[model samples]
Target: MINDTIVAPATALVKQAVAIIRLSGPDAYQLINKVFSKQVEKKQNQITFGYIKDDSKVIDQVLIMSFVAPHSFTGEDVIEINCHGGVLVTTQIISLLIKKGARFANPGEFSQRAFLNNKINLIQAEAINDLVNATNETSLKFAMNNLQNSNLHLIKKYRDQLLDIIANIEVNIDYPEYDGVGDVSAEELTEKLVSLKAEITRIIKLSKIGKIINDGINVLILGEPNVGKSSLLNALMQEEKAIVSNEAGTTRDIVEGKINLGPLTLNIIDTAGIRETVNEIEKIGISKAKNEISRADLVLIVIDSSRELSLDTKELLTLTADKQRIIVFNKIDLIDPTKLVLENFKNERIALISTINNNIETLVNQIMESYHFEELTKDDSLVLANLNQISLLEKVENFIKNAYNNIVNNYPVDIVNVDLHSAWYLLGDLIGENYDDNLLNTMFSKYCLGK
Candidate 1:
């Protein structure tokens, strides 16, 4: 609804066959006419061959496409110029558009406009950003599914179900005299609350799976000096990113990499070797290694297969006993693999690997199988994970749980309705069915210009 139109190059600023510059607002066509010298006498969804010029000089021969208001991405008149993708030509055309009264569009402004015009919901809009930022195939699939509108459709279904329950509650409250069949009774109210709880619980379960798929898992590798931690990391990454040496305490900092196991992203962190040392730098590295272990979703306690377990390994086991862990018996090249016995740490997930032998693929498969990463890939479609969505869903889940508890406690239905309403609104916010202007501005501000 701004007075001035905005324009930006829709394509990446790189060498390509053609670049597209998009303009939107009431002055879109006028700005196009000023910069582009061609008869763009085409209707909606039509492209016309044209030549772009600045005053008297020809900039480039181009094709121009125009979309009328309420029919384009921004729900306003929009013009797109398909110019040759040379940096100089594209820059000059943008400068000319500015001279013709067009301002530069902010990051995500076009998507923001689409949201403002009710062309797409907030969840779908967020999916677009997620799709662009996805780093792996799993992340890409989840974002694309969200953009497909199925997640929004499911959310709407849940919202409608909640509303129907709310309407039924009103019927009981407003018309107490109508003792019609299927009317609300104390027992009937309890049953309805139970059913609602089940429905909400189902959605909450899906959110848990969706969250893991969206955010992936963090796995930390911890071990004493020279235990092949870096070697394992290098093997997983399929590159020698970390310094591997026989010298103890070679790695004195955290090294990170991402490995895909089916659909799960393992943000693997190989930390400095944990060891007691007088050297100031190694001591600091050990401290950081412990800290990383404390924050990990999964911890791998790597032990040298040729040597006995040390005090550091024992202490690590005790500290991370409650966390999901894999006891990695590394250096199979130095061990008699046939004589390997796991009875000592029978309760833990174990993997025997040899980075030198490149025999760690079995370990990788074990890690995926132990974590449910394999099962997750069976269904690739999932919603994007973000703090807002996670928080809102947590609120909804807690409220529904509390409502179920109230029913068990024999609280009045009216009191329970408050929690149900809270749950409903929390889910509503995810889809922008309920949101404030400030929230909208903050979310869209993260987008790149011309997105």
Candidate 2:
């Protein structure tokens, strides 16, 4: 049981209509009684209006709510004070609470306490953080689903299957002569393991899609000097984010912008034009552009249709031969339409557009098609947003595979149980059945204070 009371401002410490100051612990009621002037019976889950005072000085007119232990968020006596949303009022109330024997809550202390009190599992706790930081609707949907125990349901099903397998293996090892409990053949065990591995593999693939949903796709704009790279960036963003100029090497740094297409967010980067230059700053910019190219999920190679492809452009084409790229023929409005021959460029992933004329919707549609954005968003699958969770699942998959391999090689069922048991415990770690304090501390440290 927690002994000391903890207090924190649950709302932003800015001027607004109302702000919430939360307190949780054994002394929560006594601490509030010392400051609040309301005389209502301290009933559980009831809100009461009162004036907060510090030695006859009214701090703020507030509404205080009480939550009894075992039914509250943290399974402790909790008090939430809603006061005027001003820096001074919230600060003064928190200060008064601190002086009246309540300590400040650490980051994610409330959620950590909830986990300890069995109110929420580890997956739900992590989902809360995801929901708070979700950047798009798809991410929010996945986080909400996880918070509702969707992932827990799927994981529990797998865990139960593994547990049954282990139990049967144990029974065989302990009572091999018993006629009533028939032996589970090695072939039967391998088949079950194979099915489990397939399910886990499917989940891992879906998690990759989830990662993209949570973190926007990184795209790099790459080409030689004076190829309308900056212009293309401005067009895509529909704003003058990058400085455009007729002069070469005008953009000597990377400029970035983001756009949401359906549920996916495209993080577009406008980089310095790639070319040989004696200018030291231009060389640095080119180097940074190359680095960005290496990290990009998609590369948009802008080509000037008004001019023939230069030797530098050929070299760039050779360099990006292995990357997922779309060849953009910019300045089409300035070029003769009949002279644009398709026989020269063989790449199927190509687009003809003029940023000056504002013809970029087709290019955007091409990008969407390349990644199958619509199909990915339409499906309802359990997508693991956390890297640690995905890593654990991969480990579980590997263990299952190893067990299958051992069974194929005629290893004893008891020996195969070792890997299966390890897999089971790892799954438990994913859902907080088996967890370390250090892991919990690290996970909760990423959350905002008072969460």
Candidate 3:
């Protein structure tokens, strides 16, 4: 259990009318009472008028409310003070709390405590942080849904199912006197194992989609010199973010921007054109372009309609063959309608456009279709895959898979039991049931002072 009290600023640093200073832990109330003098009869759960003081000097008139232990966040007493939000005032109040025996809260300490105190599970705690950092409306909705449907509910369901299977196997082994063979058949046990394994696999697949939503997909624009690559980037961003020119190698560096497409946010990067060059700087630019293409979630292969397909353009197309990409026939306005050949790269995946003509809506739709952004729903729940969480889930899925294989191969129930129990332990680690001191210290230290 956390023995010390922690205090932090619960609101953003932006200029606001008022700021909330939160204190949580066993000594939350004690620290609050030290600096604040109640103006009215104070009762539990009631917000009373008060004036904060420092060494008998009045600071500001404020509203202070006390939440007693076990009913508040962190499962400890929580006290919140609504004080005037000037930076100086908030800093002075936090300094006063520190001097009054309350320690500074870490970057994510408040939520971390909630997790440790069994108030919320690992996923819900993560959701709280995700909601705070959400960049778009879709991301915020997903985080809210995840917080509402606690991860503990999902983990407990899986744990209970596994427990029932284990209990049945134990009864068959120990209570041979009872009608074990007829009551719980080996075939029924194998079926249940297979079903559970499938469910685990499905959840693991969802994590990939969750990762995409939590962190936007990266799309790199690649093409030969002066193929209107920068033009496309500017059009998609709805601004002249990237320099555009008819001269070859005008863009010598990568330009990056974000574009919201449906529920997906695409991080678009405009890279230097790929071509063999004798100039030292141009060669370096070419190398950087290659690297961007390799890491791209989608490659926008741009081709100038006025010029015939060049050797460098062919090379770029071949390089991006393995990546998810869409071909763009740009400068459509310059091309003669009768002379334009549509046979090559002619499909739903190819887009015809002209940045000058302002005809890139088709290209945007193509990107949305390629990434399957339409599939993400407003109501769908999303969970991010941080390193710690991904590792735990991987271990659990692996153990469940092993148990299912053993059961299907007609292996002994005792052998399958080992894998089943391993799965249980992995899930426990996600919710801090199997946490250690190092994990606790590492997690809490990320919080900022006065969090």
Candidate 4:
């Protein structure tokens, strides 16, 4: 058990409505009792209002909440001082706590302590950080699901099944001479391993969707000059983020904006139009556009429906042949509706839009249709967002595959047991059943102080 008391300012140190100073550990109550004027009752989970005093001087009017051991966040005695907001009052209270024998808390120390006390597992601890740093609604939902122990429960289920298999293997090895107990054949073991591998592989594939949700999709906008690329950017962003002009080569640099499409954030980048230019700066911009296209998750190739297709546009179509792209025909307002013929580009995904007339919703819907958002969200709870967790899951899957291979090749049960055991330990580590101090330190160090 952790013996020393810890203290930290749980809220921002700026001028606000209130700031909370938190303390946890053995001396939590004693430290607060020394400075708080209102006598704190021995009652657990009580909130008392009083003035904080340093001898005869009054520091601030404050509200103090207390939690008894084993019921608190850290599974220890905990105190939270809700003082008037500002740097002066909060700092004074913290400094007074330090003088009263409370040491400053390290980053994620409280959460780490909770893990050590068996209050939460590794997945939940990491989820706490994810929840704190979540940028969008989807990310927040993903983190909250994991914090509720959804992933922990799933991992435990898999681990328990593996344990049963391992136990049966042991029974077979130990009771070779017993006639009453039937031996588990190699085929039966392989079947179980295959089923486990399929489940894990499904989760791994789901993690890819989780990653896209965490880090918004990158979209590149490409077209010849003056084909309404900037206009489309403004329309999508609902702001004049990029300067729109009829003049060619107006946008000689990359302009970026973000749009929320049904829980997904599309990081749309508007780059210089791809065309032959004698200007050095335009050439540099064109080069940058090519680089962005190669990295884009989705590419939008804008075309002017009123004008005939140019050689540059044909070349762009060929360049993006292997990429997921949409041929967006802009300036539809200027073209005759019946005169437009899409027979040449019928094989490619196409959208007709008029950016000036604010008719880009169809284009947005087309982009959304390309991703499997509905299916991904159907079972969105407790997605594996951390790279480390995903990597460990991959390792577990590989080990199971290896074990199945050994069984198929008629290897001894003892050899298959090695692979099974390795898989079990790796899954255990994912849930913090076994961990080293260095790994714990690294994981918790990413959290902000007082979390």
Give the winner by lDDT.
4
**Candidate 1 on 319-370: residue-level lDDT in tens?**
8988888999998889797877666897778888888887887677677666
Give the lDDT of residue 72 in candidate 1.
92
Off by over 4 Å in 3: 12-15, 39-44, 150-152, 175-190, 259-262, 336-348, 371-382, 447-451
In model 2, which regions exceed 4 Å deviation?
40-42, 179-182, 259-262, 276-280, 306-311, 334-350, 370-380
Q: Lowest summed lDDT over 10 consecutive residues: which window, candidate 2?
A: 372-381
Give a tens-digit lDDT track for model 3, residues 232-277: 9988888999998878998888899997776668899998888888
lDDT of 4 at 74: 91
What's the ranking of the predictions by lDDT, best on top? 4, 2, 1, 3
lDDT of the candidates, in the order given = 0.80, 0.87, 0.78, 0.88
Candidate 1 accuracy as TM-score: 0.90
Error of 4 at 26 (Å): 1.1
Which candidate would rank higher by TM-score, 2 or 3?
A: 2
Candidate 2, 14-130: lDDT as tens digits:
889999999999889999989889764557799998899998999999998899988899988899998999999999999999999999998899998989888899888988999
Give Cα distance to truth, residue 157, candidate 3, Å: 2.6
Q: Give per-model CA RMSD.
A: 2.7, 2.7, 3.0, 2.4
Model 2, 290: alpha-carbon shift in Å? 1.7
Q: How many backbone clashes are present in model 3?
A: 6
In model 1, what are the clashing residue pairs, if there are any? 107-448, 107-449
